[model samples]
Target: MNGRNPILAEAPTEPMTGISLLGTTALLFEAPGETSLAVQRRIWSLAREAETWPEVREAVPGVNNLLVTWREPPRRLAAIVERLAAAWETASPLALEGRTVELPVVYGGEGGLHMADVVAHTGLSPEAIAEIHAAPVYPVYALGSHPGYCYLGGMDPRIATPRRKVPVLRIPGGAVSIGGAQTGVSASPGPSGWNTIGSTDMIFFDAARTPPALLQPGDSIRFRIAGVVR
Candidate 1:
């Protein structure tokens, strides 16, 4: 561990916080701060670069930071850390080719089991909430937590809110939700802390599908409310 926050030293240009984990075979960089659109995009870009390194096993990015796993032994751990640090110093734009996907959501009522909560927080009725969520096109920033899971941006601030105090244990596949300033679709059944406002029929991830995740980093997503479910 550097004893200093990596995000503070590395990403000083942005209001991002970071932490470093010391290990024999790998070093981890964690950026802890307010989750915003720009911060999440930058973090994903960093992960894309880290993926090119032969020694790197996988670069898993979250809302604000990255967890870089390496394939080398503990002795090479320091060297890998130095490489990652230097990359941040001269970070360049990622060349990842992304695609766009349209997701249909059935917001409010039965489709959105927690639409009432959104109404409570924003004082927007279920109908208005659906309009707001579908108003803007969102950009996929990262895939996280679980496979085919996406972190998105471009949500209307009116609907932005904190995650649920108690997370749902298992949301059905294709659940659409908002957390912080972003909105996303659940590719598989999993626990989520975000506010569930609706669901989509679009399959985000499928093991049987040739390219599992329906959306990738940099893809655009627009939601279409299926209809009110009685």
Candidate 2:
């Protein structure tokens, strides 16, 4: 949303050559360009492929990057890089038949502390904002801000607003918020720069669960307006 990282910003104009090493233990595969379904699908595909490698301990996807990490750094980093490049070359856009999770939200009340600000920025009524937001079946781009938190793509640009210049100390879990061109659901209580527009009851994470994360990469989300909070 803040634009691609400097390393990737200038490269989208050219062909996606391959993955590059972030350091000794991680590989960063740059996305073709801005966050999109095609790019995210490719990233998720590469992540799944990297998991097949014996050295990879985790493969985390970002908005426009794929980061693969190893428990123990490989001795021949070049070999790993080459292997990733090969995988990228043959990788196809992942066919993710992911389940759709519908989240019921109560918009514009005490929970949505920044609702007024959002209304002011977008010049839309609270109801209009909620309608625009809930209309799309957003793709889960990546999970990163906090455990089980989702970075969702496909927000209506009409409702898009920049993050708060000064971040709030803490927002409750299940907070539906927006930052820049992206919208997301918070999974835990934490500091955030995004503006909260609503709150949902959907549980995002539970340590007792086997996978812990409720939403996986490639999944889709639909928000429903339960009612207004106030």
- Among these predictions, the greatest TM-score belongs to 2
Candidate 2 runs further than 4 Å off: 1-23
Candidate 1 lDDT over residue span 63-161, tens digit each = 566788767543444455666666765665454456666677788766578778888899988888888898887777778778898877778899887
Residue 138, model 2: lDDT of 92
Each model's lDDT comes to 0.73, 0.84
Error of 1 at 169 (Å): 2.6
TM-score of each: 0.80, 0.87
Candidate 2 on 80-189: residue-level lDDT in tens?
A: 66677788778888968877999999998977889998999999999999999999999888888779988888898999898899999999999999898989988999
**In angstroms, how far off is 107's CA in candidate 1?**
1.0
Clashes of each: 1, 0
Cα RMSD (angstroms) for every candidate in the order listed: 5.7, 7.0
Write down the lDDT that model 1 would get: 0.73
